[model samples]
Target: MKTNFDFLMPSVNFFGPGVIEKIGDRAKMLNMKKPLIVTDAFLEKVENGPVAQTLTSLEAAGVDYVVFNGVEPNPKVRNIQAAKKLYLESGCDSIITVGGGSAHDTGKGTGIILTNGDDITTLAGIETLENPLPPLMAVNTTAGTGSELTRHCVITNEETHLKFVVVSWRNIPLVSFNDPLLMLDVPAKLTAATGMDAFVQAIEPYVSTNRNPITDGQCLQAIKLIEGSLREAVANGHNVEARTAMVEAEMLAGMAFNNADLGYVHAMAHQLGGQYDAPHGVCCALLLPVVEEFNIISDPERFKELAVAMGENVDGLSTRDAAELAIKAMRQMADDVGIPRSIKAIGAKPEDFELMAENALKDGNAFSNPRKATKAQIVELFQKAYDAE
Candidate 1:
């Protein structure tokens, strides 16, 4: 075990059924007068959606706000620029992001550009920001991604078809809200994908090169929660208990990954998301077992521990055998929750594997993968995911 490491999380987090009602008061406490609410068009369009509910709360609290509903599923650099423009024009003093990872990522990019005065793409690597950002709050509408609590933001470069990860403690939201009520309306497929995304977040970090005791404990707890609650949350979106557990699991996973970093699964998934415009969580789900199978050779004991954390029965099994069981258990969970069986099933083409694999090796998260992979190995991994059924 390493002697030193750091763990990061948002300063304040509110979790429960109706904790979103506190957003207005929280904004006031931050001295934010006219915050920009960043979100996606779907939320803005849906009747009585999460964004609508947030707006109602802000109104009741008498907190002036403006809406920027231009975020996309893979959140492009253009989205950040557009939101930043709106924030400046609206005279917004702060930001409140209301959605999943995409919305929060867009808000983070907007804050970066607003503070650093450059194109968002200029700050796309570890600890790149030199200026402190304006106050920002995250109102999570999904029990996945946990972008609300993390210091990392992923933004796609629309022109280049590449996803860039920006990591900085400065990007952490000033406050975060996880209200299960906001997650009740998510569609089943999305709920399944996102829940699996959270699961991968926990597993990857548990076996990451940067894994420490603190993150191990968090990842274990997250894996247990996901194992116990993800299927129920996906199958019955209105189940508050399941939703709350999933939310907590996601947040715990976020804290683990935020400090311990991630692995090739996230690295490869980001490429698919940028290239195919695929859902991030679905990409994570399809690639997770494949990546972990490759990774198990590096630390079978840790993988075996992960199997135990994921609630797999590995009685009388060798370490390597139990490690393999972890991948099998994850695959079964994905199947039970309706995640697509393969990358090919989710619109990924084998012809693009070389390019994506090249980019995957360059991704920031790739640095912490339990296994150090060559470009050829990454390409083989992509082919394996593509050919799996």
Candidate 2:
């Protein structure tokens, strides 16, 4: 039996070693007169950084812009509201977001409600947005998440302590940027966490209920890229070729998961990040192999493919053993990248696992998991993550 799948990405994307320098004229061609630049403060202060380089290029090309550097990790309602206020005040008409998934998502969220109305909460969940959002651009700094080219924007609801995913084709950026040059100064720990995030995204989609051959192919290729290049990227941030390869892998993985839909690992990780204010990639790292290990029994052959993609040798092993090896490979990769093994070590409480599990079931991404999980099963998975230390 075969199932159908649809794939999607941004309208236009620039991916290579130095594509960030190409954005100025691209924005101009779209008639963007005033582009609101959204991102966190950390990168904005470094005049020698990518964001500043973008500004300089825009200035040289006579592109008008304003900077709103207030977006935070797990972007909040307040963050969007503040950016929206600044957007209106600045008389900006387009948006240029430079950073990881959070920056891109925050830019999309703000553009949506500002052009439509206030009360960002009404846009939560899937495909609930009515009107189209404003024109946007995404320049990614991490080799993971790949949010720059996707239509999904994950924002946190501060009041309820749950993550809200606002998804619509309108939220997709007009131009997605992938410049490995921006990746040079990224810390080793972040490099590993983000790299693993891409690996999980690729792995989740390949085994998803919604997966089709097109998506599975994309995901499998991405898996191979992450497995081969992540360690080199982490060990030597200055390695240009390694960083470029990672960006390519991350872009493909993003395309895979955004349309194919993610699964339990993302569902559980989202809850952890929203609840604990944890790093999104770090949460994904700790829970990914645990979920996949539980799922191997359902289709050990497919799991064997995952192991092979993770750079494991399955030539002589049985399917079941190959799957087990895949899990071990994933764990070792995380450890090598300095990702903490336990959620408890990162401030997650054991008692909260039940609530996190309950919310995970409601996540849009969880519905596509290869293995159907009961609430109790999800709870157990959470317990495993909690006790991993």
Candidate 3:
């Protein structure tokens, strides 16, 4: 156990059902009289969607706001630029983001540019920001990403077709709302993908080189919660109890990875997400078992502990055997949630593996991978993920 480690999360977290309704008051408390609401066009148009609920709360609180519903999945630098333009034009005093990771990330990027006055791309790496970002609040509608609680934001470069990660404590949301009710309407496939993303978040940190006792506890608890509830959440999206559990699991996993950082699963997945414009969770789900399989050789005991955390019965099993069981459990959970069996099914081509592998090696998350991987080894891992069943 490390004698010293840092733990951080949003200062104010409103969790559970009906908590979103207090967004107006929360904004007021933060002294955000005028705010820019960053979200996706889908959420803005969906009848009675989470965006509408957020708007209603803001109106009731007499808060003035402008909406920028241009964020896209795997949000790009252009998205932040456009949102920052809107923020400046509206004279918004603060920022509020609604929906999932894309929206939160876009809001974070905009907040960074708003204060730092730099191209979003310039602030891509860890602790690159010279100034603290403007106050931003995140209202999460997905039980995944945990972007609301974490200080990391991922943005894709359209020109390079590569994703860049930004890690800074200044990017953490000032306030966050996680209401399972808002997640009830998410489609089953999205629910499954996002749930698996949360699962990867928990598992990867458990085996990360940065793992500490505090993050280990959070990851283990999140693993148990996801194991018990993810399938239910995906199979029955309207199940409030299951959804609530999944959200809690995601938040815990976020806290774990937010501090310990992630590993190759995220590092590799980021490349696929940037290249194919794929769903982040689906990319994570497809790559997780493969990356962990490669990683198990580095920390068999930790992998065995992960198996126990995921509810695999490894009694009387050798460390290697128990570690393998963790991979099996991860595959089974992903299958139960209907994730595609291979990355090839999600539009990744065999020829792109080399370039993706090269980029994966450059990703910030790769530094924390339990095992160091050469470019050829990363290419092999991508090939394995592509052919995985």
Q: Over the stretch 1-389, how does candidate 2's per-residue lDDT look in tens digits? A: 12755668887889887688888988888888999999889999976798898898788779999999998988998898998999899889889999998899889989888866798777767777888888898989999998998888898999888997877878888888898999989999889989999989888888887777888889989988887889999999999988988998999899988888888999999999999998899999999889999988878998899888888889989889998998999899899888889988668887888999999998888888888999999999999998896
What lDDT does candidate 1 reach at residue 142? Answer: 88
Preferred candidate (TM-score higher): 1 or 2: 1
What is the C-alpha lDDT profile of model 3 across 251-351, one tens digit per residue?
Answer: 99999999999999999999999999999999999999899999989989999999998888999999999999999999999999999879998799989
User: 1 or 3: which has the higher lDDT?
Assistant: 3
Candidate 2 accuracy as lDDT = 0.88
CA lDDT of every candidate? 0.91, 0.88, 0.92
Highest-scoring model, lDDT: 3
Candidate 2, residue 103: Cα displacement in angstroms equals 0.7
Descending-TM-score candidate ranking: 3, 1, 2
- Runs in model 3 deviating more than 4 A are none
TM-score of each: 0.98, 0.97, 0.98
Give the poorly placed runs of model 1, Cα more than 4 Å off: none
- What CA root-mean-square deviation does each model show from the true structure? 1.0, 1.3, 0.9
Better of 1 and 2 by lDDT: 1
